[model samples]
Target chain A: MNNPLLSIQSQYWAVRDYLSPEFVAAGDFLTFKFPVWQWEKGDPSRARDFLPHDKQYLITRNVPCLRRATAVNYTDADEDAEKLLSFLDEAEEVAGPDGKPRGDDDWVATHIGRGQLPYLRITPLPTQPLANLNIKDTADEQIDEIPDMDEIPDMDDEAVGLEEEDDAVRIVHPSAAEVNSTAGQNLLQVRTYDCLISYDKHYQTPRFWLYGYDEPLADSAEQNPLTPAQVFQDVPADYAFKTMTMEAFPHSGQQLASVHPCKHASVMKKFIDRMEAAQPTEGEAAPLTSGSKKGKWGIGGMVRKVTGGSAPPADKKEKEPSGDGEGSSGVQVDFYLVIFLKFIASIVPTIEVDSTTATAL
Target chain B: MAPLQFQPLSSQPTPSFWSALNSLKLDKLKLDDSEQPMEAWLEESREIHDREKGGTIGVSGSVGLGSGAFGQESGERPPAGSVELKGVFKNYNTIEEFKATETKKEIFNSVADSILASFETNAPQLDTFLLVTFADLKKYIYHYWFAFPAVVSKPAWEIEEGGLVAAEDQLVAEARKLADDLSNRSGALLVRGPAGQRTAAPVKDATAFFEGVPSSERIVAFHDPSHLPDAPGWPVRNVLFYLASKHGLSDVTILCLRSGSSSRIGRVSLPGPLSAEKPTFVGWERNKIGKLGSRVADLGPMMDPARLADQAV
Candidate 1:
């Protein structure tokens, strides 16, 4: 841990030994063929002019993954050719059962594997050049109409000199700081390191260990890069918590119960007071319950039952009269006397009765 | 020679005595013949007799000789030759003496002169004269002169311890009698009289009276004590009294003839107690013809009394 060089050397050895058989078999297919033209000499006109068809052919050729420290000088033209031949040798070892050449699978295993190959690193080109394409003459010209680029200053480096040196090794075991920084910039780059591996059957290129990375090509431009949890803190507070898990309930049971007792007890007391105030005074009976025997009739059940039973019993028997016979007889006599008096009065005038017996006497 | 009874000498020719006796007979005959006859000889003799018998003569003498002999007498006289010669001789002298007297001619001349004088004083003078011929003076007297009462004086019976009663009293009596008579006849009374006199009677239907006068005659009514001076002339006074009585109007006005400067007429308004006191003089403001004459030509026709009374009531 004191020196990371040893760990980097060990990581390389492990990758090499593990891939030696496949590498030796890849070497058997190696051929020292020059490119149709050399583009590294700065004679762009004499170069092969890799049109879209040539780029496609190169991608399908199943080139091998080389130990970039030993076989290639990334900036040298001859070294790039030797590394390309080595990639072809490794592609031949992982040829399919049909055995002509493994196509893109062998090309991916030998040259594009995560740990074993270091022929090329695809770093993103600076986007500021394209954004500032309208800035003429090194962006320092002070023409009257020139836009104020200070409002949008360029941050890209002026010169990034990438040189090929013989001691420069492609270390598969990068420092954690480097890994974290690069992975923080884009999740796909981190995910590519974590999930991609070289296969013996397709030793020339790296294949995605997890199929999740094999997204539709059409959606690639519209997708947002994955961000870490720490980035969420920069969003507005209200929205920040909206995505977080709830910690605990905001109210206790005792507090809820206490509120209910006062509210519900007061409501019940008002209901009882309303009912009592609505009741009728003494000597004023409640209205008859007309539809069903529910409240009023149910309350007078004993009186109704006794009256019902006594009425049937009295109906069966010829009961004695309630009042005295003398009083009843007097009432009968009074009734007859009124009728007799009315009749007698009506006939008295025509009867010619003696005056002594008449009421006028 | 005692009263000279000369006998008729049949043997001797006695011409002088015969001529004298013939002259006496002619005078007697002449007196009998006064009118012209149809025949020429009778006409000539009648003219001669007319001249001799004061221009008119009454036939006289024996009935037979005086043209009474004819049963139906004509206006003609007998022929001169038909008269007895002796009758002619006796009437000839009488005719001469009758003509010399001229009694009838002289009486007519006096009457005519009196009439002409009255006209000069009373009537409006005319440029052209008109002569009215009457058969006799009695006819003129009956028709024009004495047709109305000679003087409108109160009746003798109306004198009650007085000199003269008021004209109104007489007028009222007359109007009442008229109204009574009119009522009896089923007609109305129309009294047109002087102004101060009652024009209406106290009858059951006594209505109204209107004041105005007919314009032909000149009248002169006077209320002032002083008589009008003569320079304005008598016609002015006459017309004044007439208009005052007839129309119950007052005020005097004069007009002159357009044809002559000296010739003029005058009018005076009559007064009426029952009429409007102030009377209007309707005449031309200026004498355009340089003569003082009234523009008022004539009063319109008189209003019917009964109709006027009906309107008043």
Candidate 2:
């Protein structure tokens, strides 16, 4: 709803708007900084919101996934109950270090998770704007002009302000040794998700299909999309330790086989259940800080890992499965894997459970 | 347009749990085995089925039963007066049916009429009916199931490995508490019969099962239609009579979620007992069915295609 360069109102009742304005196409390379401060210093407070906030601007700028973004507001909630963002602007006011109203510079450096990083240099430079290409009227005007610092307020709530500029357009800081060192190399491990956006002619609705890959497929390979098998091939070889591979049972043309690691739902369920079992009647919080399992995969740990955008440490990797190792043909299939497989099957109806390689976990 | 108040961009990546998992290195990540509990539940269900029947009831019929078994086999069985469970309607190769110059619509219409007739004769009060399909109907059914508190058929796959039993078990426990608290007016409890039970036997037959239950109650029984034949013993019709003659309750409504005429995945058939072609059943209308479940909505977002294509930076 923020961008007014173009507006897309959905005729299909199923989908009213985009999930995030930042929907990108398959091959679009997005580079966001993963701060080494949390890893090196192990600062618990700094652990939260480690990922840069400016990544959204770099990703949402006229990518193929969102060519002409929808013009939505809180009032749009009347049409569909989901567009309630207008009323839910729950922003907490954070005072500056000086205990007074903060300026854009102080707010960006202190409040927003990134400590010393500038907003402009968050992601790699954008060569071109691809979002509003279809809007001929707006295409004539340059929309990326940096607003004056005084024109914007230093509030923590809004996505953009006058002080800082587009993340991709800004230059890297001279003093940031880590970023400067990795100038030529890929600092962030980029994962390109091949998204197929199409309108279901029969249902008169839009469909958003996503296939994750370690590498992007070539444009010529559009006809032959990467199968789950092909995608899993690119997954880190070490991941095979926790990977559960699925295949189509019966030979069907429209078949998909995926290799998804343990689902968070499954892990969280066990954690809660264990907690409840230990204290049958007590309404106390689960003691998640003690055990190795609880420390790594507990609800709090997972929230930190997910929200902080950090990976599990290599030294304390999850205990390997008790089965015949990663290459075992008759591997036990867990409930989460089945749900994941079912989701794959739902996408490709002909897909069947590869019973030969899977069993009850 | 509303006054656009874009926040200053920060240097953080979008927060996604699965994406984080996907990005994390494979080394230290632990994969908890969540399927063990559900597998145990399946084994437990099989055990209960075995114990209740006193033996492997209708072991021969479990694989398949011929046309004669519907009538003749029931009479020849032991003096226990057992009937065929008659809950599941196995999948038949609909190629012949489709190629016979006969419209499936017409066949479905006839079947619908027959089901409605059975309902009228037995339990006319069961007016509200819902027929949902399995397999390809997942997206469609899930969209609506979020809104309505209707009986959902727990497929064998879901029960065995998808942690559905735990959810249903919780539902049963909650229902039991409510039933005890308000003794007279409690909702029905959905119970599983057996995965492949073809005979009523003495144990879980419709009559005996209902006679034991308190008044004003119903139990939802689900079966995989892949193993069933497209014949007289349709799953929906059988449940209608089973609940009606056994309990003689006013709420005779039946909702059936089954596979298609053929075992091939995309095809789905919602065999209705009273009325199959309700406004809610046939179409894949998103406005009507967009009330997604909490878990499902949390699964991911469904963005509009135009919005995805929007080029605005």
Candidate 3:
């Protein structure tokens, strides 16, 4: 499965399908069990068959977004300038000319400003039923079981409803202390986005599609399908204006905001190259997941170990697996989407979308 | 206490809804600009937060699942019966067709006529729906508007002393269970008697339910979409009009049913119950800024081949 001969499209599919032997995410709170990215065939009712059957999309749901993107308090990752420069200087001496760009794009998102919100309005929910119901099931069940509501105007703008762009509007939940005292109050109105990773055949890289369900949408008591304008506001301003486009969901045809895939491959190539250049560690594994240089202590000396071939390759490598597992051997093309999502989390840093623990590299 | 204010439901037609309209035009109704039938429904309001007390509010209840909502059904669930109300879709052949003052007036009149018909039968009907659009198919941009014609009562109704109070759990549970049936789902109910001794029956039985019971015990319950404690969803307002016009009853109790989980019963006494006259209506959903203009959804960025081809990997 680690064959260097497969095309990038096949490689992306391989990563999604493979049950990684090294990925023992069982007890890890930061990650899902295994096979983090599940493959989907999308809607069978699709009139056109433009994309391949199995690789149509990839999804990971119920990602929690705790605070508004505007509320994010970020400390610049550029703070440790000296440590970052030396790591790049080492890559420059080892990988020759191409190493300079590797450190720049992969870590810049950690320093970026980001925020999130989908439309919300409070209408008192029945207190009892929501307790035993699974969040996902409750949403689907109410569509079938519950009756439709009468048209009520949105009058109390302040007491209920999330402002599409106001910072003064804070999130409140029934489970939160004050409301909890009154039992049958509203549930925690947490804004959670159902992050969907779809493969856009046109761009040929893994494309991203996201649908945000409000607490009511999540609870199945209301139908506030997010608008295209609301979806744009959830993403960073830079990406929203430039790279973001409101595209129809390939399966449901509901319009959702998707991150344009034209430049995804180029940025992904940086991490792959960085992984292939550094040698397999024998004793303790370094946390390459760091945006900083904490685990890169011996990489310069390990660089000359005749690492087979640099990844993101026009040139191929036939390196054998150092199968003791624990990612002692760096970078399998199988870890692409994990790394892809890491890059995505950078720009749209507000959505806590991934739990894949990008340490798979 | 303050007088009650009615919240209006704004029609949120998804991009899929627009895409479906685009397809319906291309494959099915090419040149025909006549009305096409659609099923649109409303959503319930879920809460009344204490800190931000709305003196009264209008809950935007309708989630108009238009043409796009028809065909694609999910694997886990059957076709949804979600607030299945009749929606009349009139796609104007051109923007001029949409802009014609007479055309908009005629659409409004058609909805008004339906409200009159519902009042005549005293039947449970959510027949009030009107949608007009001009879809620029080639460009993938859509211009559309939805009109929920709520008949303006001659003398707007007022709330009685003592604001809405939570109905007993037993009645709420009974009303909720009956609501699961699609037939019962659209109609209002009459809950008679005190908490444990109450009997919940459809509004069709209001004549019998109120026969022996006092006006104090005969309470009306309908699905509400407003969470503001002061307001009930808009459908009940028409029900109020219907009861006034048909039964000659002006004073009654309204159990503002929020979702199916709970109920807030209050007395909304209307004086000089409305008679079936050519009903005057007042429901044109305000736009994002509370304006009376149509909204345009441009999917050109995603649909235009030129844009997709802009960046070649």
Candidate 4:
């Protein structure tokens, strides 16, 4: 073999470790598992530097769930939803002259550690978008974290968001201000999921697991760990039915509900092509220039409000990769997990687990 | 001022702890429902650094137990850099046994007896938890509950909330070292200080430690896992009981030494107390859903033979 060195690891395996200042402000943190099945100590085939080099899995714990996936109005994504506009206006007025949002105390309280009881938040999981909304069944709606509304290249990209309109949970993460104020803390309860990403030796792709907890019933105050069926309520219908399976976590051996990675490579490839295509065009990198100064949460709401429907939503166009995708201009292998999470966010719509801003490296 | 109430500290059982229980079941104690000694720990307060960068905040500590908890005789105190948590884990032979409230109450009474005995012997301790569990070997799901008992003061303890504040780096460092120190962990513990100068010594030795120390410096420091801005964690309540009843102190200062994040310190008043015979107490951990009942971890979906067979392909 050309390389027997354990230090010579996959470029993508190393990138998963570089997640930035994770949730110290957000009350969440990463849990890392070291590789277990390593070459024996005296084995001659063992790589020189160390035996088990790469991390086996990465877990971001207590990802607070403030709302349920079903609460997101998919119709809002296709329409000029006026309800959210006034809230956006409040954010804009309070935003600094340069568009950077000032740290408003109430805003922080509502978003940070505002874990409302996720069980109470759940409505029955909608398997398909309500046909009455008139949203196109074939529309490849973009995820909600996009930076600019105008950035969506009309239609027909090679890579569509994993969230196909009919089969997916919509991506519009309503700002805390968008929720009815009367619901208040009385309605909000804390339900959390532990999001785990592990490399699959069988599939050679990263596997995802979401372990969820639900509120105790009113009659008895005992713990009710989320059932597999209930956990899927947060998952988009397309992948929920087909890809998710209950499996043993390799590192902890805790039998947990998991998202199988069999189709991850195909979805990730489309993601790469689109991300690369979106990278080259500074075409009116106009909105984000002023928008980024507004901080992470404000980036989308501000852009959507500013665009107000004259422009298309923030979807990416996936032109066929110009063959040179493997070159220096290709997506950094380090950023593989970030994009994986971004796409995964579409699949599990209510989780506040991913920390990536739109300019994802 | 508000009645001093402690936010119940959650039991954070590490994967290894659960796995350790699994090994105990599979190898040695398959059907044995006897109690076994276990060692759990609370972390010493860390310096203020991570929170400013990551903006994360919450309860900073839990009764953290790992693999080494079982199968060995443990000392009364945890080693340095850790706070004392001497616990006992009882594995029931069946889920029915695990759910028996009468049996649970008897076990709880034993824990309370030990707490009272420890206090009576002039070595008061509140770092005790009772874990009643049932591990499903075939399915790999575990059902468990934790109870941390604390004696209630007769008239109730009043608290003045000390909102979140940046801990003095040097003072917290010295106090953290003492809280984690083996020699200082036993008996009642307190950190006496005069601004920059502070030291951790047994509460019994509070009189000696404060020879040159000011009255404002008599601070009882405990490893607190509470995330709330005002209320301290459960373990501190009995300490307050000891301080108010035994030591004859009315107003007390407490340092809720939270690890890995900010620590809260506040002044509390022991309003009225004096019933030594059989003190009243309250403790029973609520399930994750905030209810006082049993919680389930269903592993059939993952570990069932049929599912395993399906995934093998």
Taking the tens digit of each residue's C-alpha lDDT, what string does model 2 give over A1-361?
2222112222111132222221221011111111100111111222213222221111110001100001111112132212111111110111111222222111111111213234344322222322223243233212311332232222232112111222221111122344235323422112233222222223222222334322111212211123333333332222211232322211111112233412333432332334223231111233332332222222212222212212233222242221122111111111122222222222221111111011000
Please report the candidate that would top DockQ against the real structure: 4
The DockQ ranking, best first, is 4, 3, 2, 1
For candidate 3, lDDT tens digit of each residue in A111-223? 33222122232122223422222243335334523431221222232112111211111111122243244323333333446566665555556667886644322322233
lDDT of 4 by residue, B3-53 (tens): 766666556554445666777888888777788887777643222111112
Lowest lDDT block of 10, candidate 1 chain B: B140-149
Instruction: Quote the lDDT for B83 in model 1.
Output: 16
Superposed model 1: Cα runs more than 4 Å off? A1-73, A87-361, B1-313
Write down the RMSD of candidate 2 (Cα, Å).
27.6
Residue-by-residue lDDT tens digits, candidate 1, B76-110: 12211121111111111121232222332233233
Model 3 residue A184 lDDT score: 33
**In candidate 2 chain B, where is summed lDDT lowest over 10 consecutive residues?**
B36-45
Docking class of 2: incorrect
- Candidate 3: global Cα-lDDT? 0.50
**Candidate maximizing TM-score:** 4
Which structure is stronger by TM-score: 1 or 3?
Answer: 3
